[model samples]
Target: MMDCQRCGQRNVLEIDHVLPDGTEVKFFFCHTCEEKWWDRDGVQIDLTEVLDIVRRHRE
Candidate 1:
């Protein structure tokens, strides 16, 4: 049901990060979008850093 934020296409949906990774991050993407943008834009964030941020925010 999700659509691409850029193109508004339902065929492909991906998690897009506004920032580059230093940390584990995963985003969902449909095949078409993945093919187009994965290499150019998407980088996986570190899981530990993400968790640490979440923990700190909770505290």
Candidate 2:
């Protein structure tokens, strides 16, 4: 469980996800602050980049 950066909550929910290109990532949600973020290879990633990656692989 990771801490929520916004609210400093100690129990952020984490979900593992795979992109359209089969890239693995982790999605985190903070219940307290209603914040969401994605991580790939321990690095933070933006939702727009994730969407672009999916769009590029759709063809």
Put down candidate 1 lDDT per residue, 1-59, tens digits, no spaces: 65555566777655544323332344556655553333223454454655566676667
The stretch of ten residues in a row with the least summed lDDT in candidate 2 is 3-12
- Which candidate comes out best when scored by TM-score? 2
Q: Which residue pairs in model 1 clash with each other?
A: 23-45, 23-46, 24-45, 24-46, 24-47
lDDT of 1: 0.49
Q: Which pairs clash in the backbone of model 2?
A: none
| Candidate 1 weakest ten by summed lDDT | 35-44
Runs of candidate 1 exceeding 4 Å displacement: 1-13, 16-44
Backbone collision tally, model 2: 0
True-vs-predicted CA distance for residue 40, candidate 2, Å:
0.3
- Model 1 TM: 0.31
Scored by lDDT, the top model is 2
lDDT of each: 0.49, 0.92
